[model samples]
Target: MGVRWILAAGLWLAGCATSPPPSGLPDSLDVSSRHELTEVPFFPQRDYQCGPASLAMTLAWSGLKVTPEDLKPQVYSAKREGSLPPDMIAAARRRGRIAYPVTSTADLLREVAAGHPVIVLQRLESFWQTQWHYAVVIGYDLERREIVLHSGAEERLAMALDAFEQTWKPWGYWGLVTMDPRRLPASAEPKKYVKAVLGLERTQRWQEAEQAYSSALARWPHHLTAWIGLGNSRYALGNLAGAEQAFRSAVRAKPDSGIPYNNLAHVLMEMNRTEEALAVIRQAIRLGGPQISVYKKTLAEIQRRRNS
Candidate 1:
């Protein structure tokens, strides 16, 4: 978080504006792409607070009512005087938002095209003298070869696409698309989305995880992981019926796997369908890979319940 040092030295303005685009700018701008998310909120950064400001804008746009100051404690490093990328992602997840990292320049533009703003990390100075800063990309004009960002104090900083790429490339075109669980990014991959959902679940945000898993299943109807996660989330939230359906879907998605059967058995037991639970657990025990011991335990418990 050397971001504060850049501002103290009065180099913040010099970094993004005066620097020209790299000579090897890839010809990757989407044709016919001209979109501006005018509805996106902008929070002007105060001092080394670009990270908080950028995150605030995206989170608010994603339907959370947050301000930069409110997010400072979560994202800002008091020792570093700036925020780190990982902290920004963690902050989003804490608020039940999916903070998916955009891997490429193409993917960043796709997010903007789909009406989602992207938060990008930039090396505002030369490679030797790296100046890290975060900004929110709210618009792009491919014909004009420019991308609009809510940077520092500028509400709409129209940066040359090539220039933005030059600042972004050193960071591996690192960017983030933060949004609600139900809204998947335009360029989201199923596995990547599932990983993000897993992060949300790790935060114990079961309601958000449920929404994310449901959305994932909508896009990937037969995805085993989504089905399993959905069942788990619903079970955590005490929706035994929904959990039963989701686990059943997981069984369908991977019929040969014992994992789903085991989960289904647990949900059936919770619903007091002890006979059905016993049958399912016995199936899990028979079809088990490495979890046969756990499946056997389940069978034993069901048998005890029946005997009692």
Candidate 2:
């Protein structure tokens, strides 16, 4: 079926406007400082692949206990595109999970006001100038209407949900993932703590970024990005051994990504491992490295230096 028809059918099946307020709680609790647990009890060892069915199955397998079939009965049969159905939300609530198919920043703020946790899946522009999908949401509030969210890379704080929602709408709104305060995983709690660290790295907030990267590494040892960032930061800070170790770990964790290969090659060259560096550069070329031209130029320079 066509995408629009599928979406319409999903809206109809979900009983869109007819969804009742989530069960088991009144909508009047103060959202700010609501005191939910601050850690994820069971983060998946592998990164969950994107796609509606894949996500549904992963959440189910991760202990939410609801299958794609369960969600299927509530929404359109042909893979509803865009925001999640209200019926799906109701089912999640019944199972003690909070659900919101946020369309705007305002929608996010409203959900936060209702004393329910929020999850937001957004399409964002990546460094490669292509759009990529990411998921985060308001996990808590240390101050009124200033919320915290479980953003990829780290937790984020002091955001006005409405502002955040609106700010992010240029990207598509996929859905939200949430749970009750009591049911939230301890390891996953305080999402802002992690987000803050990643944010600093993005902004070149070097000192703070280093500390944040360290903390996240302590918690999620195999996180590939963290290792890469840690290595890069250490290299910048002149800690060669630390940087080398970090880059090695990153390459081991994700051998296919060309960025780490390129980075490692540069470091190897600096350490006088010219042959090893050339081998790494050749591997990156085979793997479709982003800096193809730069790689070519660097390889030529390396050959000239060796001849000299």
Per-residue C-alpha lDDT of model 1 across residues 1-308, encoded as one tens digit per residue: 01000000011211222223343425764534688999999888887788889899999999999999999898887667677777888899999999898967778778888899999888787656656788999998877989999998889999998888888887667789987999888989998988888888788899999999889888999998889889888888989999899989989998998888888888787787999999898888788687787778777776776787
User: What is the C-alpha RMSD, rounded to one decimal, of candidate 2?
Assistant: 18.9
Per-residue error at 284 for model 2, in Å?
A: 1.2
Q: Among these predicted structures, which one has the highest TM-score?
A: 1
TM-score of each: 0.87, 0.40
- What is candidate 1's CA lDDT for residue 123? 78
Tens digits of per-residue lDDT for model 2, 1-308: 01000000033221111001111223554334533324322121112222233235324533565544455444333343223434444444444333324454444444555533444444344355433333334344535544465443343444554455443554344455443312322224234334434444444445545655666677778777777777777766767778778778878978986666766776777677889878887887788755676666666655655576
lDDT of 1 at 191: 87
Off by over 4 Å in 1: 1-31, 126-129, 304-308
